[model samples]
Target chain A: MDLPSRIVITEEGPREGFQIEPGPITTADKIALIDALSVTGLSQIQVASFVNPKHVPGWADAELVVAGFAPRVGVSYTALWFNDSGLQRALAFRGKLTLAGFISLSASEPFALRNLNRDRAGQIEAMQNYARLHWQAGVPIAKIIVMAAFGCNFGGDVPAAKVVETVSDGLSIAREAGIEVREVSLADSMGWATPRRVAAAVGAVRDRWEDLRIALHLHDTRGQGIACAYEGLRLGVTAFDAAVAGLGGCPFAGQPGAPGNIATEELALLCEEMGIATGLDIEALIEAGRLAERIVGRRLPSAALRSGTLASLRRKVGP
Target chain B: MDLPSRIVITEEGPREGFQIEPGPITTADKIALIDALSVTGLSQIQVASFVNPKHVPGWADAELVVAGFAPRVGVSYTALWFNDSGLQRALAFRGKLTLAGFISLSASEPFALRNLNRDRAGQIEAMQNYARLHWQAGVPIAKIIVMAAFGCNFGGDVPAAKVVETVSDGLSIAREAGIEVREVSLADSMGWATPRRVAAAVGAVRDRWEDLRIALHLHDTRGQGIACAYEGLRLGVTAFDAAVAGLGGCPFAGQPGAPGNIATEELALLCEEMGIATGLDIEALIEAGRLAERIVGRRLPSAALRSGTLASLRRKVGP
Candidate 1:
């Protein structure tokens, strides 16, 4: 199937990928990787998260990394924020940078408590308040990622009805605040999604929010990340969040459990092979994978990095 | 969709699985693993290959493993053979046990020459001759695995038309030999399949041979093996070839490059989750995975085995 020329790839290696690594990565290395990624044709780069430093020490240098990178033209550098306090820090940069706010509807009570320290209704209210405050300050919220839209590591399977209800609630709040939420991306935080489940979830969301752009933030914990992306692409999802070299893992999911997000190179290869136009340089993306490995001081979880692509394999074997 | 009461699982850990491992598994360990797997609910097991021992020392114990495993009543154990000479050794045990002949059809010339030392037509003629001899001798050929039916590691894309042509050729030869072929299976040697591609291949075989019993042998190298199985199951396939604990790798595909077959427990989980019954105990299967790992002196490739199943996870967390 033919795809759009301008595919939006949001790099999540810095925030999501580094967040799950066992050892701590230096601020300098993280900044260097993000700086390198900015020029690699990515439309959006998720630089860091403003969560409690104790909770995710990997992103303790969130402010430094975001401030250090020399923002490239046409690239939207964004960060994830949860509460009003987090939103306040995000809004400090305001017009100077693009920012993304995250609010998760606790698909399950345990996940809600663990992630947001609130119930489903309480979390929605919090997100609504944050969105309103951000709009009042005249800051555009580029996107809001609804975490655990598929299933939660703590909460098992989140009902599709709940996700739709949660999204509808958020959308209503955004409308009330007079803020045009550009995109509402669903995250399979636990990587429990199957292709059929992914298709159903994306189809259901599209059915409800006809005009809103959809993006998928997938983890490869259970090895269904790419399969989910394949389903999403078939469902006409144009934007996705991926990690270079598939480096990211969910911190809550614990060690070696939550694999990195879908690798950018694998995603590109999939698109290219299917006759879809994803204007990213494949070789450069592979180089990015290796670079990610160096920054992390360990091997990245990318399959494409380990197994060269068909084109590269052919070149090596010599046709 | 409702599935049949009885499902056939062909364990390929010994022959198909071990042949791909980097180092040779000792003959004693192979025999023990095969013996352990035979007691499981597997209906058929491809114990070993009769290929040249010098080429694949891993299978040098092919004869020993077959003899060591005490035959069970409902289980049909078989070995893979690449040529008529291999077929002769396979037939030597004709009265002693049931065996299946295996051949690979190359969609490209180079792959055919490298793998089987013959082209597609030559392989077909050899298989026909083997079938003729097996028929005259009253040997029941349990199954015939058409390797590289999806695509070859060396040959790139194997066109669906070529696969259909090969199937037609096999059917004609079976008809001429006056022997009713029990089962015909396709092997995705390189794991380069997409769900849509799997569906198309299975659909083509089903459409052409209405009475044909189709099985799928897949590798998890590209992480699409399970997704491919899900599609294959949707396409009405009832039989699958899986390795215990995902213990094997494709030797030719290089280290960390070729993953093992789809894990038996993972496949069983998919079947159970989809409301299809395979009459296999998942916990018992996991035990089998551990057993395989111990014998191989390394970890298996099974995700479910490494990460506890949902049920076990719940039990561990004490829901």
Candidate 2:
């Protein structure tokens, strides 16, 4: 296996999980979860999503969560937003939150239609507006995130060509706004990705733009997230986004269709066990997962949270 | 990927789930689960374990369950046993079950000592008697199962050399009884397997015995089972053992150390979606997974059961 020696993981559990959970998960609980995650040696932690409170009541306290959490040294905190309003809300905490821009696009047209209620042209027009606003705010466009890059819940199978096409759309938007994007995150938003899809999408994107770095934001919707992540490691793609205890996806069958992202501790286990460094404290991450589960008032989907890190087991076996 | 054109899956949910669940789950529920599984186009199903009732009260009604279910014509039903008494009980249902024998050993000696309370010499001696008894009873020993083949909770990381050595022990016992073993099942009983370990172990064993058919029994303990299975597929392995709704493992972290095996439908999805034939009806198998979850009266860990197959979504996209 030609695996990268060290990889960077972007913790998206706080943003992804709290947004979907039905609970009015308290601002304090959200803050606590973020604070717990901050000490786990993660470099990037997306603490909350700045969105319309009416649409996402769960994240209505996004500002409170952002202000309450005690950010750790060397940890870069970030948040999610889709438009100028959300970006302005994020701008309130300039230094506390590291601000960056993203040109987000859906790889599947049907997904774009169903999710954002926009056609190709309308979607491009909207993103052009989004990129310009961020540039006006002096937030450098960090990367292009291609949602449904592998497959979609509404739009059956997404071929490799479609992913490449989708990336082109984001790049076009960035170009129109005079923004330079250096990375791409192929996201499996609905869990339609198999390892083959991950390989094809990553391969196709890289073939088109050799110098662009690739990251994976995988969902364990169909239980293949870890495998997809494994394939990413084999391809020497190092950046990843995971949820602690698999927060942010659907909790079970018959929910909202999309399930959890791959668990942070589990991914760390996969990487560290294979001699690849994730620079995470598996024990602390598992603790954070349990804390997230408790605050959500339900079990989360992470198997690692239940079985825990092998460190304790290894101790039992001795050196 | 040198993927297989087709693969065979052995369904072990009925036996694996019931044994661990803290339930006096009625014989009817067990029988119903087995019957439901029979229609999912699976060729093999392990229905029950004829163990001492006092030890595994879950399978105490094994006799009743064995007699109760209506088996499908094309499906082969099997059962598990360790001693002469359990074998005799299984023998009583000879016509109902397709009986086969196995030489089961743990690759980790510490695991053997901890799980079975037996040392290496003690385990081999016990297996020798067991194999001789099975041979006399006319039950062909089908395979040698190396448990904790990749890693173990009790023994930490199990080297590939140790796995080869453990398989050698099983073969030695088989040779003593003049029983020819043509297959080997590398089992990650405690969910300690990673893709690299899977590759090393499979490679080592195949190097020693070129003609032996290799099968994988994986656990999703640290959420690496599917990825390991993907690696197995890359190595051209064509046989696997899985649980419906990811049965027969630990449910949560503070529980037993081991968790579920790879979910059956998810494995089927991995194969079928990749254009590999699994001879499984993905929908029917999902329905079966739901039934297993209902019988167990808890949420299972299968993401496919929740998100469902892409067939429904495909219908939305015109051919």
Task: Indicate which candidate wins on DockQ.
Answer: 2
Docking class of 2: medium
Kindly list the per-residue Cα lDDT of model 2 for residues A1-319, writing each as its tens digit: 7999999999999999998888888899999999999999999999988999988888889889999999798999998899988999999999999998688888777778976898788888989999999888889888999988876666678899988998998888898888899899998877888888888999999999999999999988888899999999999999999999889883322347446889999999999989999889999999999999999998788888877778878887789
The digit string of per-residue lDDT tens for model 1 on A90-115 reads 77676446865554454556677886
**DockQ class, candidate 1:** acceptable
Give fnat for candidates 1, 2 and onward, in order.
0.07, 0.83
DockQ of the candidate models in sequence: 0.29, 0.70
RMSD of each: 3.4, 1.9
- Whole-structure CA lDDT of model 1: 0.71
Stretches off by above 4 angstroms in model 2 are A250-254, B250-254
Q: DockQ for the candidate 1 complex?
A: 0.29
The alpha-carbon deviation from the true structure for residue A312 of candidate 1, after best TM-score superposition, in angstroms, is 2.8
